[model samples]
Target: MGEMYTTHEEEKLIDIVLDSILSGVVIIDNKDHVIVDVNETAAKMIGLAKEDIIGNVCHKYICPAEIGQCPVFHPWQNIDRSECVLLNYKGESIPILKTVKKIKKDDHLYLIESFIDISKIKETKEELLVKEKAIDSSINAIALADLEGNLTYVNHSFLELWGYGDEKEVLGKPSVEFWQDESKAEEVKNALFFEGSWVGELLARKKDDTDFLVNLSANMASNEFGKPVCMMASFVDITDIKKANLLIKRKLEIEETVASISSMFISPKNIDQTINVALEKICELCGCSRSYIFRFSNDGTRMSNTHEYCPEGVSPQKGNLQDLPVEMFPWWMGKLHNGEAIHIKDVSSLTEEASAEKEILEMQGIRSLIVLPLYTNSELTGYLGLDNVLNTGEWEEEDINILSLASQITGAGLERRNAEDMLMNAKIAAEDANLAKTEFIANMNHELRTPLNSIIGFSDVLSSENFGTLNDTQKKYLSNVVVNGQHLLRIINDLLDLSKIEAGKMELFPEKFVILDAINGIKATMMPLAKKKDIDLKCNINIGNPLIVADALKFKQILYNLVSNAIKFTDQGGSVTIGVNTSNELISVFVEDTGLGIAQNDQGKLFNPFSQVDSSNSREYDGTGLGLALVKNYVEMHGGKVWVESEVGKGSKFTFTIPVENQITRA
Candidate 1:
């Protein structure tokens, strides 16, 4: 009995171990209807206890319907095979994995069934559905392709982005069909096979056959064995980004052009060069066809073309300010004269008068232009005109500002050039004046020395008694020769002194002396000439003798020249008078002569070198015309003024005044 208990115990243990296995197991009796044995897994799968399943028919516990309605219960009924379904339990169908087969034990028919719980697989499929829904709702287009480059799946975004309705229309198609350029297909395939991923831009065709650019990132998916199974690609539309990038690039180019132009003015060498460079730079920067610089005449009657830049065969019409035909340019001149810049974006939209100007410009292929006025010291000087920008777009405020600055620089350069020209002209004039004075000195030396040489030679022969023993008449003629020779020598000396004064080389020899002494010295020297002409040369002193500091030699030379000219120009019987007067700080000398008075028209030329009243008067005077001119210069050197009061037929009075100094005067 113990041995029998041991066998039963071993069987019970084996049954418990079998019941613990994962697969559902059951056994049926030979009748093939009732369950004789069932493991725990099988009993739980049918929602029944092991004892209940052991006695019940397997069809009642495990079939999809009740035992009376089950088709598997009748063996000859030709039931096809086992199928999976939820078993009926407690009036509800519980899902189970079922399999049924016939087992023959000792020549009796028995049934064995096996199954597995497959509910997790159904839950996993539901989860996969959720993931697909999520991908379809994304904004970015998502696509899936098989390893062979065939389209396998595509979300709604992918279909809509490519202008397709559903995945069915796209699934079997090769991904290369969406690429606008067929050559890119090989590159895409290589990227997927070698690198396993590619991210770049590409042109894609839509359903309407129009192409657009897209930024695409494609990645390959592979199984654990490293064989590529599929590929996923995500793309974003980049057409707008591409357009914006183009615009930014153009703007940067414009800025670079403007910067280059601005650097040209850092240190300009000259006005014309600066203007020319500016014109070229502006044309290049704005993409213009022509440029010109116009300068107006001072009288505002004409405009001169200073510079022009254009294509080889193009030429601008020359215009005059006054005759610009109000019908052609009504406001242009007005604005330019007012120092205003004018900008015309579209010439066609201008007024009638402006339109006429525009028509002329358009004939030259100019559609847009900017005119900047050049001003200096608040006066309009010229204009800087740019024409025919290729784009015909409106100029910005910054462009206008840059042009305004260029105009200012141009105005400054022109002003500097004009001033330099004026200085150069002044230097030329000064050089010419010096040359004229040099010629005058040479001519005067030859004229004065020739007559003086003859007089001295004749006088020396007579004095030495070389001619013969002199009679009374001979002695008188010799005396006359000596007197005239001395007079000629004095005139030559005066001429030399006057030349020195004019050339800024004369020096003054100053000393203290009485004014009466100077007058008496002059009267004593001129008495002989006056007596020969029977002219009364007198000295009148109006002030008490006053001592003053002055150059005695220059003073006496001045008095001698004045007195001698008076006596020489007076007629034989005319009287000559010398008067001296003194006041608070000046001494005045007056020499009056009854002579041929100067004409009013000849007064202005009186002080010029070698000039007489006129050429006719030069022949009548036996005196050098330089005496009076010398006197005037010497008097001015002493800080005095010499002038004449005369009428055509009346006598003349030459008056001169010198400043008096109480201290010692230097030589």
Candidate 2:
């Protein structure tokens, strides 16, 4: 060397170099193991003043080693480099990375310790560990692949999702191998590299080669230089989601089908035709080949296939299934009686107890079937069934649910049809009975009227004294005979007229007649009856024209019957008034009386033949209840309507309307 420095100068140079270093530095006396000098950085790192650290034993404040345990004494490892903790003045430990070297100057050896704080590096490593654990525990499957598409890392979730027990099995494998479509996976990878991210659904493959749906979120992973190097992907299993969506779609379809079928039967004009069309719709909805309805007999001992629907080339069983004995299907009927639905995915799978049902189903070539019992009026009336003749598969619950709804609709329709049939039969029977009664009355009319006329003729002759004159008692008896015979004749005449009207043999003999004259004649004829009850009989013809074209005889009869009824119901001294009004090609006639008024509830039955408000055997009024009914029929025969307005204890007003001129064809 060209230059040499003294010991004191060398010491000053070493101190200057140590103070300039960024890391902590300290000098220890090897003989005493005490700190001799410490740099400003060392004093700050140890949380002490330099003067305080310089005289302290190195083991107490700086180094953890005590006595002969110091690594500086080991010859084989004279230079020690390690991660250690430095004790501070407060007895706090500070993590550090340190290097120790032995130095000699002026015949004295020293241990120079160099160290740096490693707190920030340790904190960063802890944060990375937490993130790794989080990724491994995440529910979403996560994986990392290298630029060559080989899996470099996989989390526990990823291995579980792919059905792998260990990460070693997936690592180093091509990422595309785990995907169902390799080409699509590669396309996603290319897009991830080009676009930096990709997100969509993909069909993922399991370890067993089975497929499931997954939602994939893939992104390009970049190195520290910001260059894309690998791909990172996260997947969520969406197989159940897809299945739920399909089930929802199927449910909506079934709901729509049920609504369509329900609408068809709501107001069906022809129930049989509607049932057939409904069966077609149901078959198509359920993807079945046949549907049918079986009706239990009224006695419940037999069943019949009255309605059916079959696709082309499928045989119809309705024709052969008529009037089948109930005992032939014991199991089927038993289940139906319990109101339990029968759903057989495979007919051959039925148990021995259901063998009878199974045999019948097989005979009909049914592979799968469902039957829902039909209940009407709380009684098991029948059952509705759907069959699979060309295809066999388990029926979905939704399909069965929809068909169950359809079964209810069909049962209601059948019940309605049966009720209609019963009503029709009742109506026909009533009409036939009425026709026979009318014929009987028509035949009896001639037979009774001739004899009644002779009795009345002989009574009139005796009352006129054409035969021998009688004494006072005989004369009184003869008067009674004449009055009784006249009443009987009137009753006979009314019965004959009513029979003719009911048989539709009565005709309108139309002619021009004065309405005022007809009213005068009614007034004259009804005055006698009115006087007997001491009732006032008046006619009010309020019209500009009194003449009209109508059936003169029927018109007269209509007025007579109304006036007669008013007189009959009126109490003694009560008034009877016949009022007439005319408007625009029509005339209104009203017969009002001050009498015991009719009840409002009983007004509707006033126009019905033989109907009386007080029909009990014990009653106040005495007369046949046919006058008002006759009035109604005659007015309607002239194309008019009749009505009664009355309030209890008020009075009664009977009104009728007829065209001014007969516009209807004469009968």
After superposition on all C-alphas, the RMSD of every candidate to the true structure, in Å, is 21.3, 10.2
- Model 1 lDDT tens row, 110-200: 6666777667866787999998898889899999988778898888988898999978999989889988996796588778999999999
**Per-residue alpha-carbon lDDT of model 2 for 82-148, expressed as tens digits?**
7778888889988888888886766777788889888888898899999999998999999999999
| Reference-based TM-score, model 1 | 0.42
Return the top candidate by lDDT.
2
Window of ten residues with lowest summed lDDT in model 2 = 1-10
Judging by TM-score against the true structure, name the best candidate: 2
Q: Per-prediction TM-score, please?
A: 0.42, 0.61
Each model's lDDT = 0.75, 0.84
Error in Å for residue 423 of model 2: 1.6
Clashes of each: 2, 0
